[model samples]
Target chain A: MKIGVIGGGQLGRMLALAGTPLGMDFAFLDPAPDACAAALGEHIRADYGDQDHLRQLADEVDLVTFEFESVPAETVAFLSRFVPVYPSAEALRIARDRWFEKSMFKDLGIPTPAFADIQSQADLDAAVAAIGLPAVLKTRTLGYDGKGQKVLRSAADAADAFAELGSVPCLLEGFVPFTGEVSLIAVRARDGETRFYPLVHNTHESGILRLSVASDAHPLQALAEDYAGRVLDQLQYVGVLAFEFFEVDGGLKANEIAPRVHNSGHWTIEGARCSQFENHLRAVAGLPLGATTRRGETAMLNFIGTVPPVEKVVALADCHLHHYGKAFKDGRKVGHATLLCADRATLDQRIADVQALIDA
Target chain B: MKIGVIGGGQLGRMLALAGTPLGMDFAFLDPAPDACAAALGEHIRADYGDQDHLRQLADEVDLVTFEFESVPAETVAFLSRFVPVYPSAEALRIARDRWFEKSMFKDLGIPTPAFADIQSQADLDAAVAAIGLPAVLKTRTLGYDGKGQKVLRSAADAADAFAELGSVPCLLEGFVPFTGEVSLIAVRARDGETRFYPLVHNTHESGILRLSVASDAHPLQALAEDYAGRVLDQLQYVGVLAFEFFEVDGGLKANEIAPRVHNSGHWTIEGARCSQFENHLRAVAGLPLGATTRRGETAMLNFIGTVPPVEKVVALADCHLHHYGKAFKDGRKVGHATLLCADRATLDQRIADVQALIDA
Candidate 1:
C-alpha cells in the first residue's frame, strides 16, 4: 500500500522506515526542497495548501495521513474528497486549535485546566479575572514547540500579551501547578480496536519535549487510557493519537492532543513490541493494530538543535540513534536517541550519558 | 554516510531499512530494473561486472559491500581500488566456490564431510568409491537455493551426475546423516571487536531455508563461536558473516560460509538488542558494534513461493512481517515473518499458526 504523508519531516521519515518493511510505500508532500523524508520516498514539493499537489497526492496513494496537526484543515478536507484521510479533517480541525481541543476534553469529562476563548483585549482581561493570574495565553492555532504562546504571571504581563501575540484568536488557560508531565500514545483501528502504550513521563525544556521515559504500571495508566478512549471514540479516530497531560494532585489534566504519531512516543520504535509508527500505518491501512507492549525499561532523549557525533552515540551499548538527515540549526530537532535497558538504573545512566553528550 | 551495495535483493532492501535510521544513505548497483530495494535509495542499473557502473558506484559512496557470495570476485576487486569493500575480495573468492570454502574449513581444523574436486567422469567415479554412496555432486560456483546440484544415492546415480551438471567443475561430498542444521552470525568491526549472535537452528526443504529459530544457551554455542572466530580472524573479516553447520553426534561440521548477512539471522531484527543489518553497517562505517543479546524466544518463518494476505499474517500478535516487495514465483522467497514471544510455548504456537496460514 502507498501512503500519502502531508509532511515530510522526521516523523514521516520514521513512518516510512517502519512501514517499508511491511511492504508499504510512501509519498510525502512537503514544500521544503530538502525535506528530511524526501530520501525515503517520493517528495511532492508543493505547499500543503496547494490544491493541485493535494489532488496529485490523493490520486496516487491509497490513503492519506498527516505527520503534523498544523496541516491546514482545508488541505485534509480537499484530499478527503479523493482519498481517506486518517484522523479525519474534523480531528485535524479540533486539534489545530487549542479552544476546540480543550472544549472537547471538557465536554468528554476529560479534565483540563480552566480555559476560555479570547477574541479581544477585553476578553483576555475578563478571562484573567475569571480564571485568575498565572495563566497561559496562546494562539488558538499555529502554535507548536512553545511558539506563538506566552505565559502570563501577572496583570502586567497580560497587558501586552494579547497584542504581543498579534492580537489574533487566542485562548487563556489557567496554569496547573503540576508536579510532572506525561503523555499517552494510543492507536485506534478503523474497526474500533484500540491499543495504548503505557503513559510516558515527559520532561520539557523551554516548552519543548526534551525527554520521555516509558512508565511501567503507573497508577494513572487506566485513567489515561479511559480519557484517550473517550476522545478516540468521540472522533471515530483511526490513527495514532498523542494525548499530553500535566500531572497534578495525583491526576492528569489534558494538555493537548496531537492527531498523529508524536515525538513523546519515539521510544516506541525500539522500546515497544510494535512501534507507534507501524501501528499508525496499520490503523490507517485498515490492518489490525499491533501490540503496544513495552519491551523493556525504555527512554527517549530528543536531540535538539544539534546531535552528537554518530560514532559517540552508536558506541553506547543499547543505544539506537535516529538522525533526521536534516541540517543542524539552533532550536531545531535534528534527531533523537532511544535507550532500551534491562533495568532503570542502566536506563537512567544511559540517559544521563546521552544528555551529557548533547550538552557538550 | 552513503554506502554502495552490489545486490538489490531482500538483503539489500533490509540493509537500507536498517541503515536509514542511522542517517546513512544507500545506492544499489543491480541490473534488475525492478529490484526490490530500489525504493530505498538510488539505483544504478548495470551489471555487477560493468566497469563503468562499478566505478561510478565506488566514486559516490564511502564504501561498498555485497549482499550475496555469488558476486564475482573481479567486481569486488574492481570496487576495492577506489573504495574499501568489507569482507574483501579474497573472502568472496573463497566463499563463492564450495571447494575453496570447504578446503578453508578443513585447513582451519573445522570439520566437514569428506570432499573431492571432480574434474572428469573418472574423478567422480574415484570420489564415489572413496567417499562411498549417498554423496552429492554440486557446482563449485554460481549455485544457490538447491540449484546446480544433484544427489547420488549409488554408482548409477553418480554415473551421470557429473555429465548432468553441465560438465562444469564440481565437488563431490559425503552426505551427513545429521540431526539438525544451525548457523552462527557474527560481526567484526574495523578495530577487530567481534560479537556473535546465538546460534540459529535452521530447517531446509528442497535445500531452501524454510524456518530458523534462535537458540538460547545452546550447548555448542561456544564451540560454534570458536570455529567462526577462527575464520573471521583468519580473514581479518569486517561486517556480518554466517557460518552454517550440520549438527552431527552432538557436534558441528562446517557446511559453508556466507561472507555477508545470512537469512537465518533475520530474527535479529526484532529478537536481538541490535540487528545484523545495523551491525553490518556499523562495522563497515567504522562505528561500534551493537550488543547481540537476544530479546526473547524468537523464530522466523520464510514465506516461500508466495505470501499469505498481509492482513492474515499481521493479525497475529507479536508477528512482524517483512515482505520483500518482489513478484512471487515458484521456489522464490517472496517474504518472511518473524515471531517474538515471551515463552517457548507461545513462540511454537505462533510458528504453527503462521505455518498454517502459509499452507492454507
Candidate 2:
C-alpha cells in the first residue's frame, strides 16, 4: 500500500522504516525539503496548506496520516475526500484544541483536569476565580513539548501569563498534583479490535521528555487501558494513539492525546514483540495486530541537543541506541537509546550507565 | 559515512535499513531498476560489467561491498582503486570457485571431505575412482541452493550425474555419513577484532536451508568459533561471514564459506542483541561492532515460495515474521519467521507450530 504522511519529521521517518518490512510504500510531505523522513521515502516539498500539493498527495497514496497534531484539520478533511485519513479529521480538530479535547474527554465520562475556556481578560479572571491559583493557562491550539503554556502560581502571575500568551484563545486547567505521569500507547484496528502496550512512566526535564520507563506498577494501568480503548472506539481511530495522563490520588486524569505514534513509546522498537509504528501500519493496512507484549523491562532516554558518548553507551551490553539522522539543535530530539533488561534493577543500572556517559 | 553496495537484493535492502540508525548514507548500484534496496536509498542502475558505472559508483562512496559473491572479481578490484571492498577481491575470487575454496581450506589446516577437481570425462572417472562410490559431483563455480550439483550412488550413475551438470568444470567428493550440519555467523572488524554469534544447527531439505536452531549440544560450537576466527583472520576479511560445516564422527569438517551474511543468521533480527545486518553495516561503516549475545534460545524457519499461515504462526506468541517483498517462485526465499523462547523445549514447540503452518 502507498501511504502518505503529512509531516516529514522523525516520527514520519520511523513510520516509513516500519512500513518497509511490511512492503508498504510511502510518500512524505513537508514544507522543508530536508525533513528527516525524506531519507526514508519520496518526500514532497509542499506546505500542508497548499491545496494543489494536498490534492496531488491524496491522489498518489492509498491512505493518509499525519505526523503531528498541528497539521490543519481542514487539510486532513479535504484529503479525506480523496483518501482515507486514519483517526479522522474530527480527531485532529479535537486534539489540536486543548479545550475541545478536555470537553470531549469529560463528555465521554473520562476523567480530566477541571478546565475552563478563557477568551477575554474578564473570562481569564473568572476562570482563575473558579479553578483557583497554580492552575495552568495554555493556548487553545498548536502547543506541544511544553510550549504555549504557563503555570499561574497566583493572581499576580495570571496577568503576566495572559500577556505572555498574547491574543491567542486559551484554557485554564486546575492543577492535578499527581505522583507520576504515564502514557498509554494503543492501536485500534479497522475492525475495532484494540491492543494496548504497557503504560510508560515518563520523566521530563526542562519541559522535554527526558526518559520513559515501561511499568506495570501504575495503579490505573487497567483503567488507562479501558480509557484508551473507549477513546479510540469513540474516535473510530485506526492507528497508533497515545494518551498522556497524570496519576493523582490513585486516579488517572487525562492530560492530552496524540493522534499518532508517540515519543514515549519509542522503547517499543526494542522492548516490544511488535513496535508501535509496525502495529500502526498493520492497523491501517487492515492486517491483524501483532503482540504488544513487552520483551522485558525497558527504558528509553531521549538524546536531546547532543548524542551521548558512544563508547560508554555501547559498553552497556543491553542498550540499543537509535540516532535519528538529524543535525543537533538545542532542545531538539536528535535520537534516543533504549535499554532492555530482565528486571527493573538491571534497567536502572543501564539507565545510570547511559546517564553517566551523557553527563561526561 | 557513505557506503556503496553493488547489488540490490534483500541483503542490500536489509543493509540499507540497518545503516539508517547508524547515521550512514548508502548508494546502491544494480542493473535491476526496481531492486528492493533502490526503494531504501540512492540506487544507480548500471550493469556490473560496465567499468564507467563501477568507477562512478566507487568515486561517489567511501567503501563498496557486494551483497552476493557472484559479483565479478574484476569489478571488486577495479573499485578497490578508489574505494575499499570488504572481504576483498581475493576473498571473493577464492570463495567463488569450489576447487580453489577447498584447496585454500586444506592449506589453512581446515578439515574437509576427500575431493578432487574434474576437468573432463577422464578426470571425472579418475576422481570417482579415487573418491569411491556414493559421491557428489558439483560445478566449481556459480552454484547455490542445490543448483549445479548432483549425487551419484555408484559408477553406473556417474554419466547421468555428469550430464545433469553439463560440460562444466566440476569437483567430485566422497560422501560422509554426517549426524547434522551447523554454521557459525561471525564478523571481523577492519581493526581486526572478531565477534561470533553462537553456532546454529541448520536443517536443509532439497539443498535449501529450511530451519536453523541454536544448539549447545554440538561439540563443535567452540571449534566452529575458533575455526571461523582463524579463517576470517587468514582472509583479512572485514564484514559478517558465515561458515557452513558438517558434523561426522564427533568432528566438524568444513563444508563451504559464504563471505557475506547468510540465511541461517536471519534469526538475529529478534534473537540477538544486534542483528547480523546491523552489525554488518556497523563493520562496513567503520563503527563499533555490537555485542553478539543471543537474546534467548531461538529458531528460524524460512518461508519458501508461499507465506506460512499467519494465524498459526502468531499463536506461538514470541515468533516474529519477516516477509521479503518478492514475487513468489517455487523454492525461492520469500521471507522467514523467527521464534525466540526461554528454552529449547519452548523453541521446539514454536518450531512445530511454524512447521504445521507451513505444512498447512
Candidate 3:
C-alpha cells in the first residue's frame, strides 16, 4: 500500500524502513529539501499546510499519518477529506497542545500534575498562587524536547515568564518531584484492537531524551497501560501513541502524550518481537497488529548532534546501529543504537561502553 | 557506504532492506524496468553488460556486488578496474559454472557427487555410461530454480539431452540418494574474518525451494563450515556465500556454491542475530560483521507463484512477512514468511498454519 507520511524525519525514515519489507510504499511531505527520510521514499518538498501538495499526496497514497504530533490539525483535517488519516485530527489537535492533553487526561480520570490554562499574566499569577511555587510555564502548543518551556522556580521567576513565553496562550503546570520518568507506546488498530509495548524508563539530558530502557516487569506497568488505554479509547486512536508519565510517591502522573511513533520505543526495532515502526504501519494500513513481546534485555541510546564511528558501534556485540543519514549539527538527533543483551548485567556494560563512545 | 548491486531481484531488494537501516545507500543494475528491488534503491535501467551503465554505477558506489552469480565474469572484471567489487571475478567465474564449482569442491577436499563434463552427444554418452543411469544432466552455466536442465533417468532420456540443452557446456552428475538437502550461509570479511550461520534444512519442489528450517545444532554443521571455509579462503572472498549440500549417509556432499546471498538464508533476516544481507553489506563495505547466533526456532516458507493474503499471513503469531513487491508469475518467488517461535512445537504449528494458507 502507498502511505503518505506528513514528516520526513527519522521516525518516518524508520517507518519506511520497517514497512518496505511488508510491500508498502511511502511518500513523505517535509519542507526540507533534503529531509533525511527523502532518501527512502518520494519526498514532497512542501510545507505541511500546502494544500496542493497535500492533495497530491492524498491522491497518490492510500492513507496519511504523521511522524510527529506537532503537525497542525487543520493539515490533517484537510488531508482526511482526500484520504484516510490515522490517529485522527482530533487526537493530533488534543495531543499537540499541552492544556488540551492534560485536560483530556484529567477528564478521563487519569491522574496528571495540576495544570491551568494561562492566557495572561493575571492567569499565570493566579495559577501560581493556587498551584504554588516550582511550576513549569509552557506555551500551549509547538513545544517539544523541552523547548518552549520554563521552570518557575520562584515568585520572581514568574514575574516575566508569561511575557517571556511570547505572551502566547500557555499552560501553567505544577511540577512533580518524580523519582523516574517512563513512557508507554501503544498501537490501536482500525478495528480497535490495541497492544501496549512494555513501559520504558527514559532518561533525559538537558531536556533531550538520551536513553530508554525497556522494562520486562515494571511495577507501574499496569498503571501505564491503563492510562494509555484510556487515551487510546477516548480518542478512538488508530496507530501508535506515546504517553509519558512521571513516577510519583508510589503513583503515576501524566506528563504528556505524543500522537505518533516515539523515540523511546526505538528499541523495539531490535528488542521486540515486532518493531514499533512496523506496528505503526500495520495499524495505520488496517492490518493486524504484530506481536509486541520484548525480545531481550534491551536499551536504546540516541546520538545527539553527532553519531559515533560506525565501526565502533557495529563491532559491539548485539548492537544495532540506525543512522538517519543526516548532516551533523549541534543538538540534532543524527542516529541511534539499539543494544539487545542477554541479561541486565550485559545490557548495563554495553550501555556504558556505548555511552563512553558517545561521550568521546 | 554506497553499494552498487547487479541484478535488481528479490535478493537485491532484501539486501537494500537490510542495509538501509545501517545508513547505506544502494543503486541496482538490472535490465527489467519493473525490477522488484528498484523501489528500494536507485535503479540503473540497463543490462549487466552495458559498459556505460556499469561505469556509471561504479563511479557512484563505494563498492560493487551482484545478487546473482550469473552476472558475466567480464562485467565484474570490467567494473573491478574502476571500483572495488566483492567476491572477485575469479570467484564469480568458478561459481557461475557447475563444472568449475564441482572441480573446486573436489580440489578443496569437499565431497561431491561423481561428475564429468559434457560438450557433445558422445561426451554426454560417456558421462552417462560412467555416472550410470538416473544421473542428472545440467547446463554448466545459467541454471537456477530447477531450470535449464533435465534429469536423465535412463538411456532413453539421454537421447537428445545435449541438443535439448542448447548444446551448451554441461555437467552430468550421479544423483545422490540423500536423506535431505541443507545449505550453510557464511560471510567473510575483507580481513579474513568469517562467521557461519547454522545449517538450514531445505525442501524443494520442481527445483524451486519451498521451505527452509534453521537447525540450532545440526550434527554436520562443522563439516559444512569447514568445506565453506576452504572455498571462502580459496577465493579470498568478501561478503556472503551459500554452500548447498546433499546430506548423504551422515555426510555432506557439496552441491554448489552461490557467490552471493542465497534464498535458503532468508530465515536469518528475523531468526538470526543479524541477517545475511546486513552481514554481506558489512563485509563489502569493509565494516565489522555482526553476530550470527540464532534467535529462536526459525523456519522460512517461500511463496512461489503468488503470496498468500497479507492479512492472513501477518495475523499468525511470530510470522514475519517479506513481500518482494514483484508481480506474480507461475513458478516465480514473489514473497516469503518467516516463522520465529519460542519452541519447536510452536514453530511447527505456525509453519503448518502458514503452509495451509499458502496451499489455499
Predictions in order: chain A TM-score: 0.99, 0.97, 0.99
For residues B113-164, write the lDDT of model 1, one tens digit per residue.
Answer: 9999999999999999999989889999988888998999977888888889
How would you encode candidate 3's per-residue C-alpha lDDT over B1-360 as one tens digit per residue?
889999999999999888887889999999999998887789999988999999999999999999999988789989999999998999999999999999999998999999999999999999888889898889999999999889998788999999999999999999999999999999999999999999999999999999999998899999999999999999999999999999999999999999999999999999999999999999999899998989999999999999988888889998999999899999999999998889999999998999999889
List CA RMSD, all candidates. 1.1, 2.0, 1.0
Model 3, C-alpha of B35: deviation from truth (Å) = 1.4
Give the alpha carbon lDDT tens digit for every residue of A1-360 in model 3. Answer: 999999999999999889987888889999999798887789999988899999999999999999988897789889989999998999999998998899999999999999999999999999999999899999999998888999999999999999999999999999899999999999999999999999999999989999999998889999888889999999999999998999999889999999999999999998999999999999999999998989999999999999899999999888999999888999989999999989999999999999999999
DockQ of 2: 0.52
Ranking by TM-score: 3, 1, 2
Candidate number of the best DockQ: 1
DockQ of model 1, rounded to 2 decimals: 0.83
- Give the interface-residue alpha carbon RMSD of model 1: 0.8
- Clashes in model 3: which pairs? none
Please write out the lDDT profile of model 2 over residues A86-111, one tens digit for every residue. Answer: 87898888888998899989988999
Error of 2 at B153 (Å): 2.5
Q: How well does candidate 1 score on lDDT at residue A248?
A: 92
In terms of lDDT, model 2 sits at 0.86
Could you tell me the lDDT of residue B7 within candidate 1?
92
Q: Which runs in model 3 stand beyond 4 Å of their true positions?
A: none
Residue-level lDDT for B196 in candidate 2: 89
